[model samples]
Target: MRSLVEAQISRIKRCIGERLLTQELASQEGEGVIIANLLNRWNAFGKPVCVKNA
Candidate 1:
């Protein structure tokens, strides 16, 4: 799931960096909601330990 998480993070950063350009991108992909939820949890309690597999 590392790749999945990384993909989500990349998408999120892209969305943030290019909000106007990617406004519809997230909605169309549907992973936006999942990313938001994950981000919220990460912000609240820091990233999960399991994600540091590198």
Candidate 2:
């Protein structure tokens, strides 16, 4: 479980970034939320789907 979590964090660091670009505390929190939403959408769209032939 720990390694899985670490892998997710590493992915976030690699995909989005290692540092928060915002200066203010609230903005930094918002930045993290935005990154998480982005990752969720990215994963959602990247999944493979099955199709049925009529």
Candidate 3:
């Protein structure tokens, strides 16, 4: 029973890791669209844009 519980936990961790990886990959691939959408939303909210020096 203990071993079975451990295996289920491991499977859940693996699934969560895979989902996070997919989200990261999708964000990287769609960065331009994401940035544009964010900017549009910011404008709609009347937020001031500030530049930060790296």
Candidate 4:
């Protein structure tokens, strides 16, 4: 999943190479919003943690 997200970000970066795409960037702002909404419906995703305990 991490690789998939990285690939998506890389694709976007390539598409906007040497230029900033405000409109495109705005459009993608909602990319993960839907998933977050669905997760909220299911009461998923607890508070985020920066590091894992070993």
Q: Which digits, one per residue and each the tens of the lDDT, describe model 3 over residues 13-49?
A: 5643423333476775676465457546644775358
Tens digits of per-residue lDDT, candidate 1, 1-54, equal: 999888867866875653433457756466556656766876788555765566
Clashing pairs in 2: none
Query: Better model by TM-score, 2 or 3?
Result: 2
Candidate 1 residue spans exceeding 4 A from truth: 18-54
Best by TM-score: 2
lDDT of 1 at 37: 77
lDDT of 4 by residue, 1-54 (tens): 999778756754564353433457665566546544654554465545799789
Give model 3's TM-score versus the native structure: 0.32
lDDT of 4: 0.56
Write one digit per residue (lDDT tens) for candidate 2, span 1-54. 999789878987898889999999999999989988998987787646889999
What are the clash counts of all predictions, listed in order? 0, 0, 0, 0
Q: Say which prediction, candidate 3 or candidate 4, comes out ahead on lDDT.
A: 3
Where is model 3 more than 4 Å wrong at Cα? Answer: 1-29, 47-54
**Candidate 4 residue runs with Cα over 4 Å from true position:** 18-54
The window of 10 residues in a row where model 1 has the poorest summed lDDT is: 15-24
lDDT of each: 0.65, 0.86, 0.58, 0.56
